[model samples]
Target chain A: MPRSATSSARPAGTAAPAHFDFDGIGTSWQIETPRELDPGTRRLVLDRVEEFDRTYSRFRADSLVTAVAERPGTHLFPPDSIGLFDLYDRLVAATDGAVDPLVGRELELLGYDASYRLRPAGAAERAAAEASGPAGWAADVERDGRRLTTERPVVIDVGAAGKGYLVDLVAELLRGRGYDEFLVDASGDLVHSGREPIRVALEHPLQPGTAIGVAEVADASLCASASNRRVWGDGLHHILDARTGSPAREVIATWVVAADTALADGLATALFFTGAHRLAETFHFSYVRMYADGRAERSRDFRGELFS
Target chain B: MNTRQKKLALATMTGLSISAALAGCATDTPSSADAETVAPSTSAAASSAASTPSPDASSDSGSADASSSTYADGDYSATGGYVSPNGPEEIDVSVTLAGDVITAVTVTPDATNPTAIQYQTQFADGIAEVVVGKDIDEISVSRVAGSSLTSGGFNEAIDAIKADAS
Candidate 1:
């Protein structure tokens, strides 16, 4: 479960932040604000989530993503999808295709299919899937504004930054409804908007209940990704280095703080394959990455404290 | 200050300690003749001394040379390159030495990609290992962001399969 606690550093006289907790998009969510949300606003948030899932979820048979998988043609996406696709494009370029969204077929071949098989395909089956799967995103898909065109079947899995984008969308909804100071936490992907900075602990990848460090985020987004979270086989995880169609072995976990949740989430995954410095060139963010060898590196500009 | 600045300050302090240690080592082997030979053209001596592959070469020379007790006094520089998972990366390392003691050290990042450059910059800035200390329970944080805890579906499927087997 995603952990949430009131900061011990809160002012003595200040009231505790109100939390609205629920489950959506297959993960737990908690929105922290100064006041409780009315029923109408809550319904709007849930509807938005349902709308996003219906469009992007590859696991759902009726989702637009499933339709894309069934056929090869130009599929229209919602206008808001521009942000998600744009981030994916930049991520693909930044990591040299190591973080491509078109790796859905590869994930399925590795037993992360729609049915949640959790069974690895045979070596030959994996090879055949790789050969038949969509070529590189650039070669396979074309985008004109919100329109996505592909000649061959492609499993458009926006799993990399979709949840973060949804968080952003929900945040926008809350803001539109006049909630200014709030923290929207979609699982571990968080977007905080308020005057006071919120201190967030960076969980240890090897140890579930312990934290490696803390980050102070105010009016920004913090996202973390770890390879151990979704493991099934001896050396299997959800984070795949698309270049090799295998789980990335270098970085075990990563945390990124950016202006937006989508970029932070995407970069968290990108950090598995690419170095933080490379990503910093194009995006303004601070990060902490833990390597498999037990070394943790954080940017100098990273806010908050890290225990040694 | 930025992380690089903090690291540089720490590196400077470490360098001072190293310098003091080397100074102590040099004093144990006070050789006037060796000092005179190295003082005038220390750069030339340092270049040749640095190129010598064997650490025991100073003892082989048979003279109580200052280079034997410590490095030759001068500025020394070297460029090192390595192939990372991303691609080949390189950096230039330069150090200033006085009386066989390193007075200063600097690393120039020569990476082509931004990621490599970032890593190189951090490396150049100097990396201090942050040992884990306080537990999560000890600190007060509003939230914790780590690995997403959403593998419930996968675990449920596994449980169902196990029940069938039983």
Candidate 2:
């Protein structure tokens, strides 16, 4: 439910934008628009979010993604998940498998399973989990029309890229409804639409209540990934490298800006391995990363001003 | 200074070792694939020079010098391969050029691994569709096989194609 609808007028020169906040997919969500959305439009946005939540959420046993785990063989894929698949396909190529979706099993074995509980698994449990799923499943996943045939029972997690993908989808829905100049912030994965650029603060990885930098964006999105938070049980956290099956240690935090929110999110994860500027020029995104040694690297043309 | 600015501006005041130096020499560096090799400033100049392709006729790192080719107007095919972490993966390319204008192109990636071949085949077919009607010198593929090794193999074949056309 929306915590509060801030329709209150602002300063004389500024436009009085409407603000919306809600919780879904286990995170806080917010929307800001220059004009208030009609009740029908609001319902449409929520319905789309719920639909995606049901289709992709592994936490829900009835969700389609969980069904992928429950069934080992080919299943008729969700009609709309094709876009998600394509985004992931491109991301895998772009990031050299750093942005893999097949990491779901790794997360589950680490006690980040459907229950959302935080407990590190024992050595035997990890070995058992490793036996159940393959580390790389994208190449094996076959998509023909509405059918997705998997060679093996793959527990792919879209969490790394799905949240940002959903954010873009919601932004598209809002734009389709003739709502211009809007901002969609889905638990810090943001897509800011509008002619006016928005200034965003980069969250410091080590220090609480501190920002590492400020970025400005117009008609684009910003996504960040850090290995510091979401910690539980002896250095285990949300971000897991498929290669190592542990938290990324090279870089502590990463921030990337891209035209698409999903792309930005995936690139941020990739930045952990490949420094922000060192990534191939093929990816047209700008980034700034804080390394484990506390050194910072920023792209030459990274879109905003450094805090200095 | 504000707390936020203080945290960010530290890159300037403190000797945080600005690692952006890799941005310059990394452009034509053949060792761009690995992320652990970014020690620069002292060794950046030496490593970058040592890694740069000599462009000598025998140099295998650089793609085929399109300029060396005598103007041709027929179909050209060449095979290129790159050794992946697993093993050697190769791709074959055929470009039908009508007086420097590409009419059609096709890529065939040959590999024993299922995923590697899949990406190579997909990229080969896709690259042909994209490069048709364009000059060979203008063909620049940023990504193809979801993996850099596959992309490298694809480029290797394209370089060989230029050599064949020449």
User: Which candidate leads in DockQ?
Assistant: 1
| All candidates: TM-score | 0.76, 0.64
Maximum-lDDT candidate: 1
Clashing pairs in 1: A277-B118, A278-B114, A278-B115, A308-B131, A308-B132
Fnat computed for model 2 = 0.00
What are the per-residue Cα lDDT tens digits for candidate 1 across A78-124? 99999899999899998889889888888988888889887888989
What would the per-residue lDDT of candidate 2 be over residues B1-166, giving only the tens digit for each residue? 0000000111121211211111111121222111112211222111211122122233332343465533244444444455555676665544443333434433445666544543343332121111012221233321110001111222444455456669
Alpha carbon deviation, residue A43, candidate 1 (Å): 0.2
TM-score of chain B of 1: 0.41
Enumerate the candidates' DockQ scores in order.
Answer: 0.20, 0.02
